[model samples]
Each structure stands twice: as C-alpha cells, then as structure tokens.
Target chain A: MLSKKQARAFFLGGTLVTFLIFIGLTIFSLSKDVDQTNHENITEAVVRGKDLWDHNNCMGCHTLLGEGGYYAPELTKVIDRRGRPYIKAVLMSKVPWQPNGRKMVAYGFTNEQAEDLIAFFDWIDDIDLNGFDRVVSPLAKDKTN
Target chain B: MTLYKGKRRTTTALVLSMGLFFAALLYLPGMLPFDSQVTDSFFRWWVVHLWVEGVWELIMGGILSFLLIKLTGVDREVIEKWLYVIVGLTFLSGVLGTGHHYYYIGVNKIWLIVGGIFSALEPLAFLAMALFAVNMYRKGEKKHPNKLALYWTLGAAIVSFVGAGLLGFAHTLPQTNLYTHGTLVTAMHGHLAFWGAYAMIVLAIISYAMPNMTGRKLYDTGRGRMAFWFSNVGMVGMTVAFGVAGVAQVYMERIMKIEFMKVQEMMEIHFYILIICATLFTTGILMYIADFIKHGQPTDEALIKE
Candidate 1:
C-alpha cells in the first residue's frame, strides 16, 4: 500500500520529469534543422491573410492544417485543389457562397484582400505535412494532372 | 492575509493556478506569426492539448477528491492519496501523449512512436479514477443522503473513462488518426469527452452544492432524476449519430476519394439526427435550470455549522 507521502512524491516527481522532457522535445522539434515549415516565405500579404482568417473566425466552419471545425472543407491544400480564381470569386462575392446547401458567410473582400488570402493559402499549400497533405482527403492533393 | 488555508484548500488553489498558467500560454502561439506553421501549431498544442490532458486533469482530481470526501464520507487521507496517484498517472502518460497531435503536423517521426504509446496509456488514469470513485462509494460507511450527487459523480467518472479514455484511444493511433484526423470523427470524440469529463463534473458539484446552500432538498424530485437520464441518453444518441456520420465520411471522402461537398450532402441525414438529440439534451438542461430556480437563492440560514 502506497503511503500518502509517497503518493505526493510520485505526483511531484512524475510531473517534473515529464514536463522537462516535453520542453526538451519542443525545443528539438522547433530547431532550425527540424523545421518543415517554409518560414522564410511569409510575406506581409500572408500575415494579413492570417489576420483575416483569425478575425473572421473562419475556423468556426473551416479547418486549417486538419485543425478546426469540420463543418467546412479543410483549407490546408486549398490553393492546389481549387484555383486562385475560384477562391477569389468565393471571397469577393457579395452574396453567401452556398455550396452543397451549406452557406459560407459573405465577406465580400476587396480584390487586394482576396489576393492576400490567396497568398496565405499558397503558402499553406507548400508546407511539408509529414504526408498528411497526401493522406488527407484526396481533394487535398493537387489536381493539376 | 492568511492565504494559506488548509492543505486541501492550498492544493486546490495551486492546481487551478496551474490550469490558469497553461491557459495564459495560449497567447504564445498568437504572438508567433503563423509563418512558422509547425512551431505555431506545436505551441498551440502546449495550450490546447496540455490544458485538457495535463493541468485540467489535476483540477479534476482535486474536485473528485473533494466530492468523494463529501459524498462518501471517505477519509480525506485515503482519498487524497489516491488523488495524488491518479494525477501522477495522468502526467506520466498525458505529457508525452501530446505527441499524438504532433504526428501529422510536420514534426519528427519520434512523435509517432512516443504519442502512440503514451496516449494509449492515458486511459489508465481515467480507469483509476473510475475505480477510485466506485471503491470509495463501497467503502463509505456514511451515505450522505444526496443520491443525485452520487449519480452525477459516478457518472462523471465512468462516462469520462468511456468518452475521454476509450474513444480517445480509438483514434489516437497514428494510422487511424491519419484517416480520421480532421473529419467529423474528431467532432464525435470532442463532444462526448468534454461533456463527460468537464461538464459532468461541474454538474455533479452543482447538484451536490445546491441543496446544502439553499436549504432545499430537491435532490429526490422526479425532474432532477429525469434531467440526469434525459441528458445522458440524448448525449449518447448524439455521439452515435456523429460516429455513424464520421465513419461514412472516412469511407467516402478519405478512402473512396469522393468529392468533399458531395459526401457532406449525403450525410445530411445524420445532422438531422444530431439536431433531434440536441433538442432532447437542451430540454434536460432547461429542466435542470428550472429546478435550480425553484431552489431559490442561498441564505445564511443554510450554512453548515462546523
């Protein structure tokens, strides 16, 4: 039978060891050599697009990087699947973009704003997602062929 | 200012403070521009994953211990000892379990191995919790006369094991998650896990505290019992609907390589089922609120004498 003192010690000791290891792993993953994200290509436009994505709560419906509400399509490889013109049309459209009876909120973004969002999608499309992009819904793969 | 109350109070405060600390770390990912997608996603889990699996489990343990002590009249030393062990298991498994999220998100292959094994073990902590609650109930010589609270407490433990433990394990594996990661499958797991683990615990505490505070012994009412059964049944029905829809989605979208919108259109029937179950769930919640209002406000007269 474990004593209360021993149990408390186990709790504290386990937490400390695991937390330190987690931090060490985080550092290892984020190191430049392990970097899979194309960090250098993030331009001002990409940043603005991300701001728009966050501000509008697009995640309320759409998923990005396989994270977010599943109500809408995963947008990780959107640029590869759908051309820039189609996406731009959806964003710049004044009315709600209803696809398959599901309505997307009408942002009616200006052309420049649409372009910025396109840049963000372009950058996201290029990320090496440890085979996730290939294995995610086939729609996530490049259809240019 | 005598801030250092008793051991239990101090420990609870520390556990909640740690949860707050993890919550504050959510700002870290926001500060890092999404340019470094891997790092941003990685740190985001530090907040999202760590809170739900790490610090929040500690808070849950603390509350479970408090509830067990109150409802079962179990010795605090025994309950606290088990609480420590439960939390110890949680951290031991859950900290490394963060790797499960890292598997697909452009990290090293190490997460595939680490996340799979550790997350697989995460259920042991919940199992310990369920067993602890049940064993305490059996060992308790004093029945606290609040059967409704006991139901919610025991339900929280058992349902959390099923929802957070078993269902989470169902998809935590890299191979399965590769298919189910972003699909409605994740939504299926999320709804039940949150409702069972966190929401049920909150409801358990509320059920326990209300009668004592308001001098209203409404725990035995037909509505209170109905609220528990109706809400739980409705939630289970909703989980089933989501699960069926999600599996169909995995087959249609991922395996069959069908168009996404087309598959979604086919799955509209499941959403209708979800809406019906949701209505039942909402009805139960309304009944619970109506019962609470009937209890009226807490008064000094109802205060327990030490």
Candidate 2:
C-alpha cells in the first residue's frame, strides 16, 4: 500500500503525463500530412489589390468570418455566396450609398479597387477554417462572425 | 480555504459564462447561413461585441485584479478602481460601438459615423489601461524584489496596447475602414489582439497562480521566458504575414478586377509564413505545458501551508 503523499504524487503525476501525451498527440496528428505550402507572397496585381483595400480600409465596413469592426456583412463565404461576377459588378456599380430605402448601403469602390477587393475576398475564401468558430469584431463596421 | 474557495468559485463562474457565450456566438451563425440578411448579421455582431469587448474583458480585468493584488500586495481599493474604470468604459464603448456595425445591417449612414467614432474610443481606452498597467509594473519592479509576475503583466499591457490598440486603430478611421474591411490585415489585428492582449494575460495568470494553488513550483523561470519569446515572436510573424497577405489579396481582388478565385490562388504564397508562425505558436504552447508539468519537485520549505 502506498503512503498518502506518494498516492497524491502518483495521481498528479499521472494526470500531468496523460495531459502532455494528449497534447503531443494532437499536435502531431494535426501536423502530419500538413499541406506544407507557403502563401506569404503574391504578384504585383494582388499586392496592388491589397494596397487599395488598405488605402480604403474595407475591413472597417465588412467582416471576414465574423471578425473585424462590425459595420459590414460577413465576407468569410462571400465568394461562396455571391460568386465572382456579381461581386465585381456590385463593386463597380459606383453606388457609394444605398439612397434611403435599400437594406444595404453601397460603398463606392473604384473599378480597379472593386476588382482588388474581390481578389482579396477570393484570397480568404480558400482558407479551411476546419469548422472553427466565427467570432466578429465589435469594432468591425457591419459584420457578423 | 474559505477565502480561496470563494474566489475560485467566482473565477470558475466567470470562465463558464465566457465559454457559454463563445459557444453561442460561434455556433448559432451557421444555422442560418442561407438567410444572410442584414438583420441576421446584426444578431451575430451583438454576440461578437458583447463577448470580445464586453464580458470577457471584464473577466480579464477581474483576473488581472486578482494577480495585481497577489503580486503587489496593493490595497484592493486601487485594484478595484482600475477594474471599475476599465470594465465600465469597455461596456459603455462596446455597446455603443454596436452602432458602427449597425450601419451595414439596414441602418442609416449617420449611425455608421456614430459607431465609427464611438468604436474608435475602444482602442483608446485599451491603450490607457495598457499604459497604466505598464507604469505600475515599472514602478513595482524598481521598488520590489518578489515582483516576478510584473514582467508578464507589463508584457501583456505593452502588446495589448501596441498590437491591439494601435494597430487596430490604424485602419479603424472611417475613411480608412472603407477598403480594408475584410482583408488579412484585419486578420492580423484579430490574431494579435485576441492572443496578445487577452490570451497572453490569461495564460500568464494561470502560470503565476497555478504554482500557488497547487503547492508546487514546477514551472521554471527559464522555461517561462522561452515560452514567452516563442509565443510573442510567433504572434508577430503570423500578424505580419497575414497583414501583408491581406493587402495582396485586396489589391488583387479590388484593384485588379481579377476574379476572386484567381486572387485566392495568387494569395496562396503567404501560406508558408502563416504555417511557420502557427508551428512556432504550437511549439510555444507545448513548451508552456511542459513548464507546467515539469514545474515538478516542490521546494522543501512550505510545500504545504500550515
């Protein structure tokens, strides 16, 4: 029979070891067969699209997967939802505001900016969130996670 | 035991509420993806704001308050005052910031401006608290010896303010927000603010408090430092990569008028940086866990309180 102190040690050590193993296994499993592809650099056109996006601060208005200052629609699946042509057309509409009665206001994007914005949106679409939770940014202009 | 038990219960309750709220916000949106009306999106924002800047921040404050009280032995009054101000402002600005999100949700342009300005105050408030915390840590370090927790506390403040407050505010200006709305730069903010400001603090508290609670000093100073470096560097790398990629994506999609799909294919180049960062972050988390586990072999003296 074990002493009380030894028994306590045994329990704590056992629990800690088990937890470490679990974590290790999870990490290993996720890393195995990982895509191992890199996506940090892109062409000048994409970079230009990003510059235009930043110059305008589109995220302040729209959200991606529920993040960003809330003031825009959730654009995580925007590509999936609106497709490319509709998205581009909407952008080029040059209608900055929705007048008075429309449910959604139109932010005017330059023809070039509209294209870049769509490219940016498309870039995010390929990410595999793997069913992660979508949480919006309160500061995101008009967004839902 | 009574004092400890009461505080633990409170902490547990706060943690439970946060978990519940996270679940609600994360899960409920998927149920109505097809019903992508503006109103539906608004409902999502309500949860996002309430949790991120609202109750979670308050919970974080309480945790910080507890850490400050323990580490500095400061009077509860001062700490509580900090809590009141931080939490109070968070709630105030947070709720009002909902107006900014309302602009797209079938609301008027006037509200966009209102929400824009009000939400801008959120980062400033965070910045103020961060400065106060860092100042306190600095003062304490100069005056005291047993101020180990202060380092992490200072780190939490600096990163929270710089990464979350400053970077976040950079693009929040109404004019600037017009284009960067859903880009990777936004992703950069989310990663840093949530992990740096919120997660790091919470993790630091756990690192500091667990030893006291468990009557074990298994975590080593060296390992703690290693974890900090790893996590911090990883976070920065991830943010920068995502931010740049976000810019690239925006340029491709918005300016080039390229099909969004084509733009995404182009943006894949940044995946390497993101992957590396994620690996580093995971390594950091692992190191932290190792520190917790190996914080083994309690010191001989006072392993148990009399």
Candidate 3:
C-alpha cells in the first residue's frame, strides 16, 4: 500500500480526484445547458420582446430562469403552461399581481410590445430543460413539515 | 492605525475585520432592494466577495492560531510557522481573487483571467490550513481532554477544505463560472463556504473559549455534543436544499428558459425545506449560546486552573 513518504501522494491524489469530478460536471452541464441554440429562428418580434423584458426589468418583480425578486411567480414556463396569449394579456392589462402580500411593479405595455414579448417568451420556451419544474421536487417530499 | 480608538482599534494582525464582512451582510438583507438595481447589485457583491476573500481569512487565521496553541500542546515555533504560511497564502491568492467579483460587476475583460486564476488558488490557502491542522493533530503526543473543543477544531479545518476549497474551485474556473455565475450554483458554494470557513470557525472558537472564559468544564455534557451534531447536520441539509434549488433554477430559468417567476414558484417548496433546516440550525446555535450564558459572568475564580 502507501508508505510514510507517500502521504503527500495521498493528499495530492484525493484532492485531484475531487477536482476531476468538479471540472467534469462543469464541462458536461454547461455544454448541455446551451439549449437555445436555434437562434437562427429568432425573429425581430422575439428580439424586441427580449429588449422589453430587459428594459422593463420584469425580473425586478418576477423571476426569470430562477434569478430575480421572490415577490412574483416564475415566468420560465409561463408560455408552456398558459400559452402566449395569456402572457400577453397579463402584461397588456393593468392587473394587480401580489403574492404573499408583496406587490409587483405596474408596467404599461402596448399591443406591439406585448406581441414582441410574447414572441420572446415563446422563443425561449422552446429551449429544452428536460423535466425541470414539471412537477414537485422529490427533495421537498415530506420535509415541508 | 493610531487615529482609531475603542472598538475600532486594530487589534491583532491589523487585518481581523468584522467591519466589511458585517457591512456586506447589511448590503443585502434578503428581499430588500436598491432604487438602482444595477449599481446596488455591484456594491452588494463588493461586500460579499471582499469579505470572504478578505478579513474573514484573517479571522480564520487568528482563531486557528489560538486554538492550535491551546489544544495541540505543540511548540509555539511550529504553530507560528504554520500561521505565517497561512497568512501568506491567504493574502497572496485572496487579493487577486477579488477579481472574481469583477466578472459579475460588469468590469474590464482582464478580470476574467485574473479572477479565474487567483480565485482558483484561494482554496489552496484553505487547503494548507486543513493539512496543517490534521498534521499537527497527528504529531501531537497529548490530546487535550476537552473532547468538544477538539471536535470543533478538527471539524473547522476539514470541513473548510471541503466547503470552501472544493466547492469553491467547482465554479471559480472562468470557463465554468461564465455559466454558473449568479445562479443557485453560487448560492450552494456560498452557503457551504461561509458556514464551513467562517461560521464553523467562529463556533469552534466559541466552543473553545466558552469553557475558558466561564471556568466551566461543560465540554463533557450531552448538550454540548447535541449542539455540535444538530448544527452541522442542519447546515448540511440546508446546503443540499440550496444546491437543488440552484440547480433547478439554473436548469429551468437559465437552461430551459422558463419564465423566471414561474421557476421561483416551482422552487418554493425547496425554500420551505430551507426554512426547516434553518430552524434546526438556529435552535442549535441558541442552545450553544444558552449554555454559554448559564455559566454566568466570567469570574476571577473561574480562571483558576485545576
């Protein structure tokens, strides 16, 4: 097995293995995660929708891709769940969206902008994240108590 | 340094600062906001990154030195040598490691390479500390009878390596950082690194110093053992909850391009798990603090050696 002189080797080797697992996960996941590769199909409306999303700071109220304020519901799968029209209606109408007593900032969206934002959501919605958010997390099972 | 007085006085190596570290916590108090999100975020990150890579390391060194001397019963010469090496490694990798903060701050292109390399090395300093502790532990002929203090001392060293060193390097590399940046992945590392390196050490120091300060030999108590295990297990569970939430967040929001708010809703249950875990962690800490208080005010008689 290992000798006293080989202790440094044990340290180096163990650390090296852990290092390998980390970097390996990084490379594998990052490459697979670039799911929206068909930017070739990105339209002007979708581009404008993205711009609106940014300038309006919808992220200030709602989360996008799990990055944002916790005051609003997630919009990542909104298009899939409610369809493009629903998203457009929500943005276009002057509606109150408060979850757990926190208020969302009101934004006035025009028909054209709403159309563009809808397209953008549709574009991103097509990107594959496998089974993410499709159901309740198994890790949350029986532990919510 | 002379201009400062009272609590502001630069005690120890002139680097032990809870100022910037605590100031950074005040920067972002969870669910709070700045009027200008962009500028606000930049400064918030400045607090966090500067803290972990900065004064917190000095705190680690100071506490480790005190504990090693008290527990290891080793020659001061050997311990001080390790202290010098740790301090050197800390500043060397750490200052440059601040560049990692710049990558997210919308700074210059040079920070990409600079932060990447240095931040990667940040773990090396922590690793050295780990090796130092375990090695000294092995070499020492007499282990202190205070079993709880030893648990904490050794735990701080080893866990810091795993949490700060390994988990940190996981995302420190720019190639990975570019993708994992700002996602729950960062949260995962942040929780573990902060808990392992900073929180655990402080607890370890308190565990060591409490008995000395109070002259109470409570180290052998069941409550002491319970406090240690409950806190550690609760934190590890919390780390896992945060990890999955971050991963799901990244996958749903970043990868699948889900509407961000919807993803947050999906991950709501995980936060519930986080709350449960946090409760356990807080209870454990409260138990520790309560026990420390029960010993009453530190007295001259308590300092009397057996």
What range of 10 consecutive residues in model 2 chain B has the weakest lDDT sum? B30-39
TM-score of 1: 0.93
Itemize residue pairs with steric clashes in candidate 1.
none
Which parts of model 3 have CA positions greater than 4 angstroms off? A1-96, A99-145, B1-46, B298-306
Count of clashing pairs, candidate 1: 0
What would the DockQ be for model 3?
Answer: 0.06
What TM-score quantifies how close candidate 3 is to the native fold?
0.63
Model 1, position A96, has a per-residue lDDT of 96
Query: What digit string (tens of lDDT, one per residue) describes model 1 on residues B1-306?
Result: 122554445454555555656657654654655455567678788777887888788767777777888999988878888888998999999999999999887778788888999999999999999999999999999888898889889999988898899889989999899889889888788888888889889889899998876877756778989899889999988998999999999999888988789999999999999999999998888888888886757656555521
- Give the poorly placed runs of model 2, Cα more than 4 Å off: A1-145, B1-36, B141-148, B218-220, B296-306
Residue B6 miss distance in model 3 (angstroms): 17
Whose DockQ is greatest here?
Answer: 1
DockQ of 2: 0.03
For candidate 3, what TM-score does chain B get against the true chain B? Answer: 0.82
Better of 1 and 2 by DockQ: 1
What does candidate 2's lDDT look like per residue over B1-306, in tens digits?
A: 443466355432443355455546655643443122233344566567656766666566666666666666665555555555565566556555655544333323454565677678778658766866765554443343323355566677778777767777776665555555555667778888888668888786876776766675434477677787898898889988888887886576545545444555676768787999989988888888887776633555636452
True contacts recovered per prediction: 0.70, 0.02, 0.04
lDDT of 1 at B229: 88
Q: TM-score of every model?
A: 0.93, 0.61, 0.63
